[model samples]
Target: MGKKSKKGQSRGGNSQKKTGQKAGSGGNKKKSTAAAAAKAAKAAVAKNTPPPSPEKAPVVPEAVKEEAQNGAVAEPVPAVEPAEDSKPTADDSGLSEGVEASLVLFTESQQTLIKNLCSPPSNQAHLFDHWRKPSGVVSPSSEATNNVKRKFVAQLESMDASYPDGGLVGYISNAKTLLANSKSGVNPLEGWKPSVPTGQMFDKIDEEFEKVEKVGLNEVTSCGFVLVAGGLGERLGYGDIKIGLPTEMATETSYIQFYIETILAYQSKGDKKLPLCIMTSGDTNDRTVKLLKENNYFGMDEDQITIVQQGSGVPALEDNDAHIALDPHDRYKILSKPHGHGDIHALLYSKGVAKKWLGDGIKWMIFFQDTNGLAFHTLPLALGVSVKFDLAMNSIAVPRKAKQAIGGITRLENEKGEQRTINVEYNQLDPLLRSSGFPNGDVNDEKTGFSPFPGNINQLLFKLEPYSAALEKTKGIMPEFVNPKYKDAEKTVFKKPTRLECMMQDFPTVLEGEEAKKVGFTSIASDLCFSPVKNATKDGVALQKNGTHPGVAASGEADQYAAVRKIMQSIGCDITDAKPATYSGITIVPGPEIVLKPSFVSCPADYKVKFPNPSSIKISARSSLVINGSGVVIESLDLDGALVIDCEEGASGVISDLVVKNDGWKKVRDGSRDNEIIRMRGYHLD
Candidate 1:
């Protein structure tokens, strides 16, 4: 049995040898079959997929490359360790190390953008440090947060970098520092005294009126009126432009219309066209431009007007110094706020408006706010004062009434022994010092007998050359003040955060030695020129009721409107005192819809000669009329409502004959009524 098993094993061994030789010989055939299968699969894939362009080739990761070389299947790659400085190297993201680091807080899409667009490096990361943990609470990392960070960083890096050597970055940094260290809470009455323009000085001003008038007229051609119309009418509960708010006039004229008409009237008195510069914030710029264009620039040449967009700032975070997010849900959009009036100088310089003014031979500039109806009324006189004194800057002030909550004009002797004119804000004054009979606290100049410092109306006349020089000298840096304001006025009961703002009138504080000496102050009647329309209900309604008295209705639109009417009536523009329309025992005098023609009166002295006996004309409270030009005859005309008469300069006509009687009303009437409401326009009697 052993011999048989050995033989069988030997036979099996011989069979195995023979099988191996056959397998070796046929190995090429098996390999060919495998190759054919692989080739077919490859061809199928090639037919279905398009070849990638060199520019759009896919980037294979390093891990995959190592796996391919080692003949092993690629495994999921582990996250690469960030560089020691937490910067991304070119090998990591194909972006500069700094840019990668700046984008660390950004999302994958943002990282891809940094990789592709090659954006410049910025200190945005540092700026965003405050936003990282708002209210000292770390928010979960999200796309929304990343997007917000990206936008804020972009804005910071993209600001106008054209400011001489300091650039926008330096300006922002310096401004932030100054605001952080500002003396806002200090008492201003420590070294304060009253200073005012005297009656003698006014007499002197009047004495030089003719010469000043001539000089002012000549200078008007070289002067640009800068209207700081940057504020939104939100505080007034108005969505439309504040300057476009209607004033009580026969034609329902707007403040802008009145302003333009006044400017045009002054322009008509001379051959030189006065240039008007409007400084508008982002919120108001477009609306202002549209309003002017729609009205054909109010008959003034478009070239005579220059509209400049002022810079805006973002609201700071409540808990941190970073900017506030526009949307809390997304936290991506940073909300922007209007920079204070102090931005005027920087805006003028940065926006090329100053350069344009200089090129146009504009030697002087008057910057005033738009809320005041009489803002530009005495600009000629103010310009005259500036020209007469050869002053670098002339500030127009009005006497501060007892307990008036307005800043007062003050003169301070600085450390350098230079007397600098400064505005003592009401908040900065001690309550005891602000009280009447406070010794040496009020601005009382004994020499001029002009006691108590006059309140500033923000009417400034700047000698363009020196003003430009001063702005350049300081790199257009202005002191910033922290103003507490609500983030959402409707929802939030508490103040959202403090806003940083600069006051344009604070220019004198930045000046030194000789520059301070160039600053001067002049006084004007507050009732005539300083009435500001601040609040909607308070201003519009109160002014309509109370007139221009100092204690009128907390200083609002109504007071300003009342002041304008009184000023007009004081002149010979006959505003007939018809009984105010009454409904439910409430006397309703027309608020903003009243309009008076500019040709009728430009000032208290320039009354239209056509209306020689203005008091002889009668008007009803329900009537809206425009009396243009001379030779108009009125014969007991009863105007119930809505009438316009365009009297030609030489054409003589009677109001009764000019009336276009409504035949339908006449036929329907009982004929017993002698008076009826009439709606007529451009009618002439034969």
Candidate 2:
């Protein structure tokens, strides 16, 4: 919560090799001033994980792997045969002659730092001492393996001055848990009872929603927004950052722009400009920053947005000793992996952003994932639920399909026998249910025809003070687990070095008694707010044929357009289906393409006010309307083709009494062309 007074001096890289290599790689300087290095090295353990490559997910060391939202992990791998190449390449002699041979992989400066911190008589020596495998005689590991112990020592000593020594101890404890989970094959839901959690459910945008939205509108000025966008859009067929993609082609507004606009729009309705914190990984950090800088922070103040990067290079662990794993291709490189989005909490806390928001008088923090256009549409009502219920934590959820890929919001008893309503991981949900006496195991409710356990989209609302309190208790680090695939039943060697992972959605686990009671969910209609852009066009088609939901850009865009049309029809407009368009072997439902700019109309109440029952508005098949501008009002209009009305926020728009019907932007599916939007979403407009 205080200033990181030592970061500047500490971040300057303690040694020559570390000069430009960010401090996390265990680069502490002189022994006389070695404490800071110990702190910096600690960063490699908690901040994030995954290797230099393995862009998707760091392969878990266990047969079973844990996956985070926005990404998938491979299925259980078979017991691997020890490949000749993967074995450690020892030096000519399999014994350490001196510090030079043992610490060959380290820079001279790093070697010295390790010695000063873990040499005999130093209390921290145990950290290095544990890296050894002592037989009858103190036999040194193979020269190559000696370097691993040297790495272990340097990693432990490289913590920052700001990180308490206690924090380093905490990470070690987590590493032990990772070892236990790897051996036991972690069932995170062990000893827990799973059942539906109680919360408010909004079936539609009715009077109740409008009433709650009013409360949310007032609360907007006091809230902070956190966006989890640590991954790219490769799965969605976009080669760049997913958040940079457009929500819909109507105005072709980039997701980032819309998010900023939505925040500002709500701010304008309330009092002050709220802060936005985006969590990024090594993959998306530079581009995300460049995007904000290039677009002038999307019309918001530069300081209003804070971009924090997750430490992607987490050192992988190989066994129960909490030994740092070596890379298959290169032993010098400690196999780093992504720590999952759960790193956001620790990043926010370690970087002091969460505390800063608290200082700014922000009472609430609303968290959402990137590339979901409908999330903000229902955010106001959801925020209202948080305020009205005085909730400590509110997860915005949707009715889930049986055995869906998504995690379910369930009330469960943890290992401590404490009850917390949280998102139970999808993999663990069914098994836990079946083990707990539910025959069908995570099936749909008979009456509702949907899973009783609400679907989690990773969108959440937190009452700031309590959330911060919880973060501080854990030093902002989530309880992380390591997944290591083993080569045999003995669990002696790894199939592949694995990484540590935690879920940001696992926050409720950090809470105690009554604070846990305050954790709940706000279930909203899926059609209104649950469209996620996740898969690529080909993958979508493949998934569809296999009876899976094709959560690709095409479907996301279609859902957005459908949401806009449904909202219009509910108000007063006569909206009907357009001719069906098929792309990538999947048939997009018949519907007019409509893009509603939040500036024009955000909530159901706003749309109802602009167009009453007698307003007389009808949008025909193939009509595409793009509307923007806060002052835009349509009292009467009829369109059969593309209609674009764009203006400054307070300027005139496509006003009332208009009848325009002409050939609009043509929908073209030319595969050879270079239209990014069409190519990514499987349809183009020329």
Candidate 3:
């Protein structure tokens, strides 16, 4: 169970004194004034002087004491330790007997810190009033516990200062309670319903797309984009930044370049520059920033892009023991880990970016993960939906195939008996319930059927005002999940406390029950709009052996590359043979030698004018056709292996049976190879 606060208790203010004065008789005006003046003077003094050392107790002003005696406030009292013969009671400070026993393991220094932090006389006690006692047993000797406690105390102190509202501490404590409860072997998905977005509303997506495009053009200035790119390309077998990896495009552009191009294309439709915010983690921040600088911000104004780094959190001990050594050199120190994408909300608020967005008349923010390529074109449509429906939170979901192994968006009654929408991760659902068709079960609503449970793809459009207001109301308290991970590559032991994480998608739950109506989920075409590059290679055998679904065999990079090629082809680009062509048992490679400029076929509408009679041209995928100038010609040619056709202004070529394996062919002024061909396979170029 979570911690509970006393009814009518107020925080961070003099509400207690105000309540007491209101209850007092009207005759003590002079005394009340004196007390108020004294309190003000003490506050002023405390502001000027440095904070008292943690080694000593804080000093209370005599004025405060007088006010307490006069019923204006309650006197501070230290928590009493139960007698040796007495049994622990539930009403005792949130700490349980087991947790108290575990604290005995901490060193004296750690004990002092914990005591000061939780004691009634301490200023921080109120911040931790909601902490529930640990339910699990934790036994450690004084020395061992002391070492662990020291590190924990230091981490807590730092977090307290960093997040004064107690979000970090509250989240950690809540995570501990959740982990303990989950160990009972009960299904976490009990009573929960899983459903996806229904696409029955909009008749034509193209019409909706056009409507959204118009709205986006009108509100481009008042909108912003946030890209969550905090992760490295380690999972994709790339040691450096993932966004910088080259894609299989005609120009061999990187992921970041494609994203930038898309953004530029969208901006070109309007006059105002849209702000692009990139949320990066510590590992990827520097490299990402450097790459952007080197590329000249990808043709976008540097001022329009803002990069913010998310904060990190301390990793918990595997045994929940305070004395365990996190490292060989330092028994008390623990490793730090990223606090999950959920921290984006707090980080944006803390950095004042959220406030700035609100002030800038930015009504909506389009947030998408960095690993996606389709996200570039999907933003305007998402924003349009938010505008059309006047929604506070709108998420874009894609259809989930059977056993897709992704989280699904569902509507269910929360603990308060109010209907709400949530993202139910794959692992959170019970296998029996999942296999039985879940929300589509007989228990589903008679009026609303569940044939589609659209999977969440992390593409969201949030109304700035309501979203920010909701965040403030929740005080950034996000649901934390414990992700058990190995402490080392050997996987011998799991890290303690597990990894506490939160998700930004869960922010919709923070809104009041009534506001739930303003939140919605919209379905999108997965092929056209959802392609996440999570892994480098598709290990079908490994995935099947582990009982997990092996999604598309094609890599994310390959999928994106293919999508781009398909779009270009649809635009009537005479590049049907742009793909690698096999000849004589050898596969020829493309790119660097064969390139397609974005200006040639910017969109499908430009196809007819760019390439008239597209069937007349034969451009092999592996062949290199460099059209630096115009008037390029395409004729019958038996092309095989790598072939280079450089056409200048007013140049044309007519070749036949061109077999240039391990060789190169340069088009001369007369539209013919200088000497039939220049074979340089395995030979140096001069």
Candidate 4:
């Protein structure tokens, strides 16, 4: 056993280094065969079904290694294709590197066996000549089941060091154990567990109906809004505030203007304009504020818009305080990458932002991404639903039609036996389980009878107090890190797969047992869910000038145009042909009175002309030049690509539509001795 352990570790190490090492390259073939038989026997015993004698174990075929290696570079094998009526298989082209190998290598036979076990009698393969259990564990008593549970726990703990980080086998096995023995009173479902049916996870429309009958919208005084504009806009290979990307509907509104307008829409649903805040990073602060003033704060009254810094931190594994260590270049390049947005909880609380909002009577905080303009900003339907369910955390779920996308919330057992909502990303689902058509498998435990939910949308609303408690608990418990796959662009062959340290689920961590029970989450299917704008063109594949319908328009909608469209639709305007003019910069007021005039001003448009609300403003041009003036207009320039505008208080300027190969270091030469805020914007061809 010791020898086999060392051999397994050595193989894993080698596999980690070689980009495409053949599985059969080394002469450890004999050892692996012996180990597989032994491990399979042990697993069978542990599962308490049957055990196989040495003679009955599958013969160690020398050709197996050759076949395994061939499989490495083999063309897609359709022989083992999932049964048509079994389960829907997600198109797995988007799977990250190493996940499949790490998962499949450890349990290939088990997966095959499980498939056979569940197969219809007609499709049954020859049964394995094996025994069910070496020992009996038939007792139904909690004590007896606990004894079995302990053995399983021990097995898991023992394998942690050998398996790759975030191995799915360990996760699944643990889940199974929790389900099996969870009938004991220790289960969370019977207590403060949030995923409990009556707790955090409530029926959406049903709950709202109750709330409407009770409290009513007029009595619902609390509102919350979260702004997630912290990521760098480098996906387009541009080094500027992606939030500042300019796109105009037929009305000519900018992205920033659009996002603010959406918030105002939410405010309009309630009594007053809600307290709004922006989560800014070091890379985007100066430009974010400049744009804020440029558009008259999106018609936000003074003191309503607040800016909070999302302070940087070190990665969980790095054991350092700084999350990003700059590169050698003076340009301040990114290092280990930003800690996942899960870290945002710590940022909000530690920075006192949460306390500030709570003191201001804000009971709920809606956390959403900035690039998703279509995020159902603040619909009465959603808010009312939230209040009715009394959900601690509520998310909006869209259909999971794409296999490449992350899996939504599903019920998973914590250390304590209660079922709770734990987010499983796309890669986390069992390939076999997902392929088996049980997207939401029989997650229920015979013991605890506690089953949570599946599929968690990124759009979340949490009550401030419970959220604060969860955030406090999360600090001591680092969530399991799922190392996803990404293209290693720096390698000689860019196609090679590399590990990305980010966790896409990005849900808050909870202490593995009953402590996690306090965090309940619910989901609802809503077409008004937010969609991300990632590219610059309107093929619905990239970012562009118009807004996307909830599921319509795959790409090209500027955030502003999208937000305006939502408001127009919310207020009963037929948005079918209400295209915001190109750069029709928007100014939002919760009231229905303010109307915006359409404009077709080009890039380098003046800040004042686009937004007449603020008497003063500043201007910063990312690429093309800007001229101060009454109304903004973009003059023809030698460069053209994408442009971002950064402006200051009490000032307006004109921008030009020019795509500069580079943001040239040109001198403004305007001799002015004023502490006026001079903002900067950038232009690039993405």
Candidate 5:
């Protein structure tokens, strides 16, 4: 991709005042660079009518009226009904002048860089030069629109492996299609060109990554890292702070701790202790702060770690039947809603983090959630992968045979019929996806399916400069979402949390091979990246309570057991004499029949055992059961004293009556439940 003008410098201002405006008042006076993006989205929906032929429309829509009130437009908008007071205020005039002034800061070289940033990659190369030469002007007549679309298709049809000019001409064709279809009531082709205009500053960053030195600990020393830890533990019953829940074999270890260690380790390798930032939600920020401070930043430098408060914008729920917004307070009294992690891009852009990091010499920005600790490897390894592939990489996991969870990579064709990347969940998986070599198996067991899912871990690595460049180049390319938007008005009338997934993948595609190189993406093996502390069962809880973990196990224990049993028979051990051996707390038990190898016994260990690994012994309870040092004992008295356990856990299990005597509660906490054989907060007792 060619370079563009250097219009990528950061602009600082009050975000709220600049992003919205009142009806007929035009857009906000103080516009951020992101505001001038194409309105093709809304235009795409209004493709039927011919576009207004003027450079700017005389009559704006009711939507624009509302948009004006919110100050959402990037260009200076004239008042619909000019009033004496409607004249541009000094601040308004200054903002308009300021934007144009700022654009001028970019040199010719910079504008070229910006254009490259917006160009698509070679593999899926097809350009839309709406920012430069739009199609509506070339073909104001309906026949011209048809001709333009046909010509664009013809160009794609002529493509070979090595696309001509890396699909540069295809881009110009796309812009034409957009203009022909655009009904923004404004002529989209005014002053259009096959490329970005000169003297109009445009900042450009390569979408593709280039190897800096092999990333080392030294690089970590100077970088500042922050994790988005804003989600509540609602899915897990919200009994405790999700961030504080023990996720490591040692009770002291947690998801956040692992994340912290990984980043700190990278920094340490560089011999530069880096600063770590954690964005916590309002509900858990206090406890999170205390825990971090008490632990002295969990083995990292105290000053190197900082906790910041995340967003509190909860989308209002709506009643489907009444078609009215509902109060979230009606459900949970203490629900501290967040605007979702997608807010990171906007927040960072507006909050000046991008500039701050740039000044601080941070070259790349890696973002991840605090749930999965599997891909929480140090930045060196992740950065190495990113640079190696020249991609804005995302760490993914191969889907289970047919596991049905949300979210997966999607491949779609744009108007140019060029392959593009889209990330959506299983629900949104298009019909084309099923035929696209995705895994497919039994519906019940998604793991058995034929789909090969790149399970997104929400881990991303991006060249910070390139990301900023892309933002500058495609400024205001995104739509202002009405957040917390729910689908089913009855069940989920909450603010539709419109995911900014488009931007994450879209930006990379926009910069591929030109301003950027390519967007690299692949899946990491489960063993290498599989530590997720899902608070779902007794076993998971028990594993965290005990000190035994399976982090370093090379092979499955069941396989080990099978091997040992065969060896025992070869050694003439008496298999008939074998009986259940009770062991606990990191104890190694040799089979009475002299098995070749001894199996290690861990009580809570089973709780945190890695998924898909089979356990030797399994135990489960329907009503209630007691787990003690003697091993799990059934206490159902309804079996006529003949112990007969009905439930099963892990692979298979059946246990019968044993000497079970207990009043149930083992602890004396005043708030704890009593007289219950099995105690779990959210489980239903029947």
Candidate 6:
């Protein structure tokens, strides 16, 4: 094992490479079984691969060198036939002395892999066409280039042996198609017609769904939850993993804690421990893991949690030619960005988490994004709708006005009669509508009072078996689109680098025809189901007047408080709706602040069982009530100040006609507050 480990550490076992040798003459032939898997395959490898300069010869081993050679040399997708024009010499530097300096860094088999990965028939060929040379080229150039020589050489040495060939090829193929479409002035939806889908509205979900929620409640044991928390909190002015930020000002619980506790709350009602899979990216993985370890998985059983880090980022492209982009400040590095949250699906599939869930009797997969604050509040009914309709996919939606920044779920039919139900990004929907016969484009519906197309919240649920099977067929790769901001009308240069991006919501874009019908949506009231802390404090304020949503920490905390207050008001409690107020220059949503545990009221019908209230519950202005236990009973309550009742899981508390008149935790504008949520809300305790 040690020998193999050392062998793996060396560059594809092509160590101690003594140079000054001629090409095409095999001075040292380190044979890879994969490159020489068969007569025809060896021919392919030899045709694409450059020869080695070492003295060793005829060194063919019996074991296939998959880790070193992969399928780069022997296989062909043949989207286009390999030709001389498709070779790396498209940059005219393939034969440069500097190229040879970079080439000998890898074993001959590894070189063969690199060549095939960038050459013709391989769709990534164009990426090498515009670069001064392929990624590893180290030629005599500018002073800056010389300074980064060692770094570039290291990049060449560490070339991925396990890079996903299929995904890279698909990406290049998509880019080429998009480039052509742009040049020809063709639209992706050229022959397609878009229409609004009357998805099942939970607001009006037949009174029969009270039974549906129960059925969903029963199915909780067979479900696994996924949290897509790959992003960082940089946009929110925090320096940690986004999930590590406090969700609300009251409990200061991290978003991950809220999710885990919510799952645990439902787990209590079921017989099994439902597994949780969190998808993180390179940016957040270490911090996220440390957070989980420090909190002991946030009360989750160690065995019940799985963290899957996202695959290596997709390469950013510089222009329509799809040349791989280099880091602007450091040319030695490839500029790679998150492949987008859509990678969560691919990660789950690649890690075999989805398959294991299925074998573990988990029949549903609930996928939600980070720090929404209302996903768990809305998940139960959505899951029920999935089970109720036997849907392969369910996108949680909220009422949307036309042209809102949020993507809208729409059903589309192509000229060929093939159909799909997917989220049409706001930018695309208006034009699609104009082209599809609506002259006004994206106007409100007279009957629905809003756009018939509901806004996509990016929270989705999938039936496990079909979901897993579909992913298996595609190897978990979603449809990817690249949007390059061309610096020219000819579309030859990019103003900035761009990469292919895919959305988790776009997962259903893969299903079509009758399979597409199996994909639908569930529209819930936005106030009750969607309050995401995604924007910065300032950006939220800009969108506050838009009536769509502010989507920041201030709005998120305020939304949490408002949600609970409405629940209380619905149950005959005189929960006063406070007028819109300001907290450190940001508009606080109008409502009383009421924060409670997930167990405080599982549903509106659940409060009666917990409190068994008789009458007289009034929470007035300048006051907030926070409840943190399922065992807490509230008979009659009147509060004019912050009244916090915190109880442990096994503990109980009873507050009868309790009243508080003193000053509560004031919303003092403390810029030095360590708590990010409170800091962003511009407040902290005295």
By TM-score, who's the top model here? 6
Which 10 residues in a row give candidate 5 its minimum summed lDDT? 196-205
Ranking the candidates on lDDT from highest down gives 2, 6, 1, 3, 4, 5
Worst 10 residues of 4 by lDDT: 675-684
lDDT of candidate 2 at residue 80, scale 0 to 100: 21
List candidate 5 segments past 4 Å from native: 1-224, 234-238, 249-251, 306-308, 317-338, 378-381, 400-403, 411-413, 417-420, 434-453, 471-517, 538-686
Deviation (Å) of 109 in candidate 3: 14
Model 1 agreement with the true structure over 488-562: per-residue lDDT tens digits: 534222256444567889888777667676777666666556766565443444444664432211232334444
**Where does model 4 exceed 4 Å of error?**
1-221, 237-239, 268-273, 294-296, 311-334, 377-379, 402-404, 431-455, 473-508, 511-527, 536-686
Q: Residue-wise lDDT of candidate 3 within 205-322, one digit each (tens)? A: 4555556645645554467778888887656544567677554322346768777766665556556676788888768899999999999998889997888887555444453221
| lDDT (10s digit) by residue, model 5, range 155-203 | 3233211122123233233323332233222332222111101100001
- Those runs of model 1 whose alpha carbons end farther than 4 Å from true positions after fitting are 1-149, 158-176, 179-221, 315-329, 429-440, 443-451, 483-496, 512-515, 538-595, 608-625, 628-686
lDDT of 6 by residue, 208-251 (tens): 54566666776766779999888888788777788987777555
- The alpha-carbon lDDT assigned to residue 500 of candidate 4 equals 21
TM-scores, each model vs. reference? 0.62, 0.76, 0.60, 0.44, 0.43, 0.79
Clashing pairs in 6: none
Which regions of candidate 3 deviate over 4 angstroms?
A: 1-172, 185-221, 320-325, 414-417, 427-451, 483-497, 538-554, 568-686
lDDT values, one for every candidate: 0.52, 0.69, 0.51, 0.39, 0.36, 0.68
Quantify how close model 5 is to the true structure by its C-alpha RMSD in Å.
22.5
Clash number for each model = 20, 27, 14, 76, 80, 0
Q: Which parts of model 2 are misplaced by more than 4 Å?
A: 1-95, 98-173, 185-187, 414-417, 434-441, 486-493, 613-615, 652-654
Could you give me the TM-score of model 4 versus the true structure?
0.44
The local distance difference test score of model 5 is 0.36
Better of 4 and 6 by TM-score: 6
